[model samples]
Target: MRAVVFDQFGAPDVLHVATIDRPEPAADEVLVKVKAVAVNHVDTFIRSGGFRTNLATPHVAGRDLVGTVVAVGEHVQSWQVGDAVWANSLGYDGRMGATAEYVVVPAERAYPLPAGIDPIQLVASVHSAATATIVLQSVMQAQAGQRLLIEGAAGNVGRKLIQLGHQRGLTVVTTSAPRDFERCQALGSTQTVNYAAGFESHFQLADQRFDHIIDTSGKVALATNLGLLKQGGQVTLITAPKTNQFTFPVRQFYTRQQRISGFVISHATQDQLATAAQWLNHAFAAGLLLDDQVSVQPFEAAAACHAQLEQGQDHGQRLVLVPSK
Candidate 1:
């Protein structure tokens, strides 16, 4: 197996590909022949060592991949050879796999790719977007006919939120750069705002408060979003607001009866992934979740992809990576 490995993280240039032995499936695990892998913001954080987690030397950075089952351990029965699957590598205990030609899975973490879905595009959205759906469905308890606001509306999770929210009959509002307003609206965002332009006055004057909010953008403060939420309304914080940006504690969020909670997909149950995957496929089939906008690069260019990611600007929605041919 040829994989991209970095012992130490600093710059994208530090990543280098090397051929290593393919991992064998342990009991209760499945060995997969990798086809496609999706890059998430987590991958970027891991590569740059931006998170508080300390991973010891020699880390293979990637958290999601889609592939075919080449072999299954004796204890595995739900999956058989040749089944197509996508999985979430939640970085538990700094496990190594993905970003390779072949990898092993615990079987439970892998789900089959349904019919009528483009494998690559499905992989592009499913793994990370599951977190977004979980934020709405599991954590925030978004209900039908409610108005749901999604921050980072143009990013991976935001795109899924728009589609999944609409599927659940929730009105979707989103914040993105001005360039994505039309596209965001098309993605079922009933009202769209460009937060970079100036969110305070814009959202404040809208005269309407959201029933549920999914804050994927770290830019929105708990206090700011609390003001945008009606009493008893809920807000799911996917990214925590930076401490330096505020002097006083974001106290109103607790006293105002505004429900503010953070969503972590790693902590989700298997049932949660199954539920999210079903909705993702249904929405994609309905044209609410567009896959045509995603762009894929070869795995050799993982470093380059990280560079584009670090620069904080891109023209597309999802950027997938495939192990070199």
Candidate 2:
């Protein structure tokens, strides 16, 4: 199998397409024939040695993929050969990944792909949609009719959050660059705050305090935003800060019962992934999730794609890699 492999972490130049042994399924896993996979920020982060987990040499570079099942392990009774499926890459913490002709995924992490759904669009939506769904459904416990604010809402996850908020009848407000204000509105954001000016700009236009706030941007101003949250409100941080520290209004936080939470999708349990997958499958079948903005490239162009992403050249579209023409 030819795969995008990296022996060391540094720049996109470290990645290359090379022949590697195809992976076999374990007792609880299934072997998938690769079709299309997505290149994500975490893939770049891990490739550049930014994550804390110890990396194994010759690591594969991809996170989410859609493909057909070629084989199943003895214990994998729920799936069989020829079932179309999609899954998050099991590539972190010394596990093998999906950027190859074949990859193995634990059965629980793989979800059935609905008929008539385009694999390219499905791959683009998997990671970001799942992350936003888990955060809104599980972490933030967002409710309909509540006011929710999303910071840095121009990215993939932020767009999904806006759509999900609208589907649930929540009033969704977001902070984004002026360039992305109209795009965010098209994705269902009720209000757009020009964060390029300042966070105060968001506060200025808000008519009411938010019940929940989700910060997709790593830069957080918890101290200044505490006043923007209503009593018993919550804030969810999707990314870590550079300084690895955060300061907030401790007195107000305690007095108003406000809460802060952070999580990485890499740590999601099987149930969480399943819940997200099921929702996405239904959404796709219902023609609800549209990812026409994604960019598709050849699998062998992994290195160039990573470079483009690092240079901010994607123009806010998810980049996907198809294994072949």
Candidate 3:
């Protein structure tokens, strides 16, 4: 098996493909012959040691994969030897990843892939779309006919939120660069605002308040944006400030009955992954999700992909890797 491994992570150059022994499935796990894997910002964070989690060195970098099951554990009764599956690899929890020819995933974490879906598109959706699902379906409990404002709408999770928001029948407004407005609109945003022009000057064209706001920008303050929400509206943060603590305005929060929460997909459980996988499978099968815009690269280009991601050059396209033959 050839895996992308980083012995001491500092830069993208530290990541390299190495031939290693293939891993076998445990009693509760399954071995997948890797087909495609998506590269995420979290992969960079973990590799560079910027994330808060403690990881073993020489880490195999990646989290989400689309693959075919080659072997299942003796106790695994639900899946078979030839099932096409997609999974969140749980890489942050010291689990092996899919940036290789093979990977071992906990049986509960892997889900059968929907037919007629592209492997690249399915892999792209797993990590980011799952987080959006958690925020909308679980945290916000968003309802149809509601309104949502998605901050940083052009990024990976932000793009998924727009599509997911539409699926839930929400009127979606998004923030992004002026150049990305059309792209956001094509993804189903009813309104798009360029935050670079000025956050306050451009965010809202109407006097309407949003029912829910999800901030993926990581730079916005909850205190500053609270007024944009309607009374009893919810705000969810996928990204936070450097300090991790935000200044909560008690008076405003109490007066408007606004609610706020933060979510990190790294902390997601096996059950959550299963739920997300099921939902995504249906979404892809229904023609709600497509692979036309996803970026494909050879698996060996992982390091170069990481560099482009770090410099903020790669946006608007979900990058997935196909294993090199």
Candidate 4:
């Protein structure tokens, strides 16, 4: 099997396609023949030695995959050799990655792919949708009829957040560029504000206060979002600038009984991943979460895809890599 492997972490150029031995499933695992995998920003971070260290030699760096089950371990009864499955928990925490012709998945982490969905679209959505699920369902514990404000609502996770939040009966408001207003509205945002056009003033003028606020842009100031929250409301921060530091009105935050939480998909447990997978499968089947802008590339182009993401050139498009024959 051929895998995109990086012997050392540095630039995207460090990644190269190499012939590697195929891995077999352990008693609790299953082997999948990779059909398509999505390239993520975190993959670039790991590849550049920024997010994690002490990786395996010749490490593979993909985190989500759509594939077919080719072999199942003795203990795996839920999946057969021909089942179509998808998983998003690989390529981190010392687990083998999905950017190969064949990868091993722990049986509990793989979920059946929704019937009649494009594999590229499904694979493109898994990583972002899982993150959105963890943020909304697990971290914030968002409820219906509450007003939810989403910062940077045009990006992948932001788009998913809008759809999922709306489906959950929340009144979804969004902040993005003017160009994305209609796009965000179609995704389920009831109200859209141009972030560049005096964002705080727009909300303040409307006297809008949200039960929950989530910042996916990583560019919004913490203090700015805190003012938009209602008493006892929660603010979830999933992305941050490189500085990773913020100054906010701590006294006011505590006095109002407001809560702020940070989440990363990598920290999600197997149970949380399973729950997210279930939601994603249902959402995809229902045609609620789909990536219309997807660029398919051969496996060998992994480095170029990583470079594109790091350079901020993806332009809200999902870049997918398929195995090279």
Highest-lDDT candidate:
4
**Residue 169 C-alpha lDDT in model 2:** 86
Better of 1 and 3 by lDDT: 3
Report every candidate's CA lDDT.
Answer: 0.75, 0.83, 0.82, 0.89
In model 4, the runs with Cα more than 4 Å from the true position are: 53-58
Against the true structure, what is each candidate's TM-score?
A: 0.86, 0.91, 0.90, 0.97
lDDT of 4 by residue, 176-228 (tens): 99899999999999988988846888888889899999988788888988998
- The alpha-carbon lDDT assigned to residue 182 of candidate 2 equals 92
* Best-to-worst TM-score order: 4, 2, 3, 1
The parts of candidate 1 lying over 4 Å away from their true place are 52-58, 177-179, 194-206, 241-255, 269-271, 285-288
Candidate ranking under lDDT, highest first, comes to 4, 2, 3, 1
lDDT of 3 by residue, 56-125 (tens): 3447888888899999999999899999988885567767866888888889888888887777777877
TM-score of 2: 0.91
Q: Which digits, one per residue and each the tens of the lDDT, describe model 2 over residues 134-221?
A: 8988898889999998988887888889888888789999998889899889888988887764665457475469999888877767
Error of 1 at 150 (Å): 2.2
**Least well predicted 10-residue stretch by lDDT in candidate 3:** 197-206
Say which prediction, candidate 1 or candidate 2, comes out ahead on TM-score: 2
